[model samples]
Target: MKKEESFSLEKGEANQELDDDGKPTRTGTWLSASAHIITAVVGSGVLSLTWCLAQLGWVVGTSFLVVFAAISWFTCILLTDCYRSHVTGSRNYNYMQAVKTNLGGRKYKLCGIAQYGTLVGVSIGYTITSSISMAAIKRSNCFYKYGHDKECHTLNTPYMLIFAFIEIIMSQIPDFHKLSFISIIATIMSFAYSSIGIGLSIAKIAGGAYPRTSIGLPTRTDISNMDKMWNIFCAIGDMAFAYSFCAVLIEIQDTLKSSPPENKVMKTATTIGISATTSFYMLCGLLGYAAFGNDAPGNYLTGFGYYDPFWLVDIGNLCIVIHLLGAYQVMVQPFFAFVENWSHRKWPESGIVNKDYTVGCFRINSFRLVWRSTYVILATLVAMIFPFFNEFLALIGSMTFWPLTVYFPIEMYISQVKLRRNSFTWIWLKALSFVCLLVSLLAAVGSIRGLVVSVETFKVFRSMS
Candidate 1:
């Protein structure tokens, strides 16, 4: 068989003319793009919102959610235009490419470290979250078999390995454009778990046995003033993490067809996706906090809010596992593509790195097979080593939120449109960026402190009940 025929990324596209970037022709619509966005944006982070909301109280927590969503939406609009270069009118295949094109120099390198690092961190976070959901399912059943107060704890290592094994196989998917079905299913699972959480919260609130409520900060007497400050910062970090998904916006947009123009389609998709995500965030955060007040658990579903409805809780957790399976891929594919593509360029003649074998209908690359599997295993190891869910989420969110989500997009947009320096729009954008930088710094500090406390009290691979 011919080399081209044997190593094609997608079948049936060998005969078609390549896209402007010499890749397969894109067939994604706004709807498909929306699905990908929803899958990537609305993820396991949603489960932690109620705890964050509880810490921030009703006023600040709710306000932060709205503010973060608006910021993410606006910056995403800026990023969509950067998908295609202004001077060359050529497509920027990924976020790094978009940054390099518009904001070249050392900033391009900085964007890469931040973007890819965030992607890898997110993958590890997902692995940890999926494993927790799996364990939660087992514990939920144990509680049903025995009682809610019974000692029923499960180990997360085996579940993390199971999740890793599944990802190793799914990571064989050739390209981002080929992930529509997975994204669609993951998006459905996201909605399913989110809806379940909201429903459970509503039921709890309606039962009229909820905990003490608060209006400003959490009113718990056990929490010290410094602890309250850190919690508030960490909560803001969680909200920031919940809303920001710009890292993958360009990659998702790349899958869209060019007839209606990719930028316009992506803008519409961003609006719709962010709108849907924010609605879920608001519903879950508000209702969950209302349900449990200051004592809301970090994970609404797996945190044992309702043990009576054991079956429903199991289903909700299963949905989370399934959803993370896909969300992991959606977020990590770009990182995979970056490393694999670079390896192919660097060692064009190395068979192990460049060779692709035919496995039925799919073309599997040797480098992809080895490296992708290795990456998943390493991520699983990290997940097991430090499975601090809320703290980990906040840390990753705080680290990447400013540069990747806010600064790069804003700077790239300014460069693309040639906004005059110190003008009203320039001043406004700079001020926004500056404020977000502070938020990110504070969130990072809070997350680090939380992680420190967690590490001091916990051992490696500690199982939870």
Candidate 2:
């Protein structure tokens, strides 16, 4: 086959057929298209989603999830149609690409940069949270086994570093196809973990192992005005971040060869994935709050005693860490590829080094080494400085999640209108589009406020410490 034909075949296999400009043409199957969407949506966020919801009280949190899910579903539909209409024949188009195509190129570049920054921030946040969760499990297990060694009274930095190293190494592998299998495992494990925790929590409540009380719903007076605003903002931020991955559906659609049958399958799969994620978050949040009442720590495991005989939490933590590793890989691969493309002179097109000094031993060119080291050091420092996981999550959601989820879809829809005037028929889509834009904007603003507050709170806590 000719080069174009060869490229086309490989692209088709990956669910992406490139146009002349290297934009993906819609040609892949639905399953292939939705894989990354599933991965992107189901990350460390799910693990903490329950805790975030619990903070707002169960009723509010559950309501937020339903509303956000509905909004996200509608947003995805708008985005899918937008892509089908505007950049239909191009494989080079992504969310940012769509923005650049319709909006100014400079704005698109800025958005792309913001997206990368947010991914890095998110990766660090996930690492830190996973490390803490892992450490909790380790400390609990050690105490269970060694019965609290007085001589080993030092902080377990080694364990954290080891886990971080493992994650860093795992994230460097290039191929996401193989990575998706791991994600499938992680998803299953997450469900298993949350299910067991919920069941155990419920059983304990039933048997009076824990106290349950109605502290009265959160009244305006009960929570201070400022606190209420902060909580509402946090909820909006959570929703934005939770639903942000909706923007990725276009890339996924491109990979599927844009087959009509595949589109339907992708839509169904996307819905199922979102539904499952929402259900998991809601259950974990409700059960978690119900079990511990108001004293419940943000992490679900905190509700249980060390002797709770529930090995699922530990297993779940481990599984989530693994899943996050996979997630980090998916999130960062595009960045890596972009970097490689930009620095082609220093690095060859093929056999790019994937090793990190922090985690693995491998030969690295000076350029690659410097970049990799810089990324690691910077990411580590930020994570350590802002050691609060929820705060980092909020920051990421506000800055990156908003653009990807709400803004990008609106832009894509407008672009589609420009490209295929009167070609498609969606009578309610314009109204739906407006609703997405409004909610997304609200969520983004609320998330930013929450992040600002969290950072300020962190600073205060730091000074006190």
Candidate 3:
């Protein structure tokens, strides 16, 4: 078979795939690409980073944050190279398709399962986060004055319904390229929440507002060494999930104009995006720990002492809700596209395509309306059912880190970037790849253990309630 026939990424004449409302006249600029990455990467993950840092203490957690940032950046380089692997250097619709281009056949199946599962898992996480943020906002008015009022009446389901209502409108716009306008605002939303959290931490420190019960630091003096180590592993899982962006790299790259060395432009965008993420993570994680120590809340907004500047707290948290509303769709779009693609392959005659369709027998395209909404509803329902779901989501997310973030990228680089056999560079890359595989195994096990414990504890709390 010819090299051209062997690869699916080389969609020659069909390169001009239209978004729902518009045709592409030019390639996406690096800034737009950076915005998409920023929107996707810096979601609710930034809020709990203080707790992550506390779990590992400042030195270790900060180190892991930097390390994960570097690792994420490196893997991003590898994925971009894979995006340019074809002779024509065309883009793949997803990482799975890109892998199929190189490895061929059902070799990409695991990628599909793991990739889509991770995305759906992320979507569920956003559902939970948006509800929590809005719920916090709902109860904020009565927070400090707990004794003076009726019990704060807030529920996760209703807030999730509100989010679903908003998403239904956004979901109607089919392609992610169309989300560029929304993503720029979503990127600002990350900055909004992170900046507020940082400002609050500084204010507390300046005012000397440390609580006597608050832990100054998590250390051998504060806890057992076993607990310290366990928490560090948990932090690893947290940062791993936080740094995950490779799952959507290809789809983002596809929107960019197909030109020679466009992947170079992608590298530039990755630098900007990940650097912004690192800055926010460091500021929030370190300052949050400094302000509250081990007593920091899992969600930083609520962790504040509920002081007089409660209005600022509400603004930051509402930003979280707004951010997740956008980020949820960013993650979910890949799952939506994957399912849509699957349906098209299975039913080539189906009218649930990007193209306008005639109402042959049915009044409308039920698959388009029903299937998409069904998944969104399903994700929202999961969020409603499992209130204590972050740990489980982290577990599922960690499942993708090794393969999607590290192993696949390194493997593709070794396969696609030819090097002299037995050369020092070649040996070193292989060794690093092997080490990542080991680390991924350990991280996955730790994440799973955390999930199990969270489930058991949730049940215990449920029984008491």
Candidate 4:
């Protein structure tokens, strides 16, 4: 028995303390859940909101931020209930599991595709975003030394490789349950960078050196109607991306303690998390737009909107790099877990796939190391291939926003509650879902158009200006 226990521990299969559900004892609370959500939600997505506000202008942009936040919170409440099946009254460990338990069959399979696809896309997006921040750090210093007129051009590929190396190491972390510390650190880094961005914007506007402002739509004569329309749609998509954290809602909730009723605790966490996130989003997006007006760069800090106080700019960019390091793991760990768990189940008898070796105090799984490192490498390669920050952000956001954020949650809720067809509640839910679908479709079209334009102008594997 002692030898068997040691083997299990070596294989990283030991769950010494099981909860009433016979799983690892969950000590997560509303606080930790909020941290995880904030870490996931307020990432590179926040950086793009200034550009988003530029496209949509003040009224529409601010309204969209609030609307998206409300929608996310509402659907999140529904999703929280689906954490435990209505019939079985048992836990569904992940988003896919919740869908499978409540709305099984084709819908379950669909949820997997949307959820996992979003995860993979988000990993790539983080790669691109982090690399930009890394390069921005260098570029900011270059301008400070060489004068603003000097072309401080920096290639993003090298920084991307560095970021990938870090992710490759981070990917080895066993699972989501162990990422609370990283999440906490990431949460702080997010606020640090966001606060910095807000402060810089405020300074710029107060200095009275900011660009001309716009109240309604961006009526810039330099751009045509087609360009304006596309920008608006893409802006909506970026907003969608900014407010989205529903894909990981079930996973985060699963980490919470069960005593207070996980659903109740999650709802409260969702309220607090989304509320705080929205407040930050508003300040960052609006203040950034206020500072730069219609000329706001897709990435405000990295776009060199603030040239002086170079050290502070570098610090904010560094914070972004550190934050993304943890954010990448938080977003990608679920995908890693799904793939590894599936492999273990499929090849139960395969020693190479199932075995884990002890490295000092760490348990390193052979299959996990190879598979996860490869995934990070591939994601890095893709990020290098298409590093258009805003366009990629919009594409990923539009693709997953409706399905994972709005559709799956609503469908699962209706199924679990057995709501009658065309009932008042059902009609409104379906209507909201339908409206979001249209928004996503329009945003996707705009994103694809932007990508095409970017590719036409940008040289593949070449340095981004």
Q: Residue-pair clashes per candidate, as listed?
A: 0, 16, 1, 0
The local distance difference test score of model 2 is: 0.59
lDDT of 4 by residue, 349-408 (tens): 998789989999999988999999999999999998898888888998998889988999
Q: CA lDDT of 454 in candidate 2? A: 64
Candidate 3 residue-wise lDDT, 294-349, digit = tens: 76677777665356476888898888888887887787788887887778888887
Clashes of 1: 0
TM-score of 4: 0.95
Displacement of the residue 231 alpha carbon in candidate 2, Å: 3.3
Provide the TM-score for each candidate, comma-separated.
0.95, 0.76, 0.86, 0.95
Which candidate model has the greater TM-score, 2 or 3?
3
Error of 1 at 83 (Å): 0.7
- Per-residue alpha-carbon lDDT of model 2 for 224-337, expressed as tens digits? 787666656655565556655654555455445433434466677677777777777677767766776654554566335254453655676676666666666556655655
Sorting all predicted structures by lDDT, with the top scorer first, yields: 4, 1, 3, 2
lDDT of each: 0.87, 0.59, 0.73, 0.88
Residue 324 Cα positional deviation in candidate 3, in Å, after optimal superposition: 1.0
Error of 3 at 440 (Å): 3.0
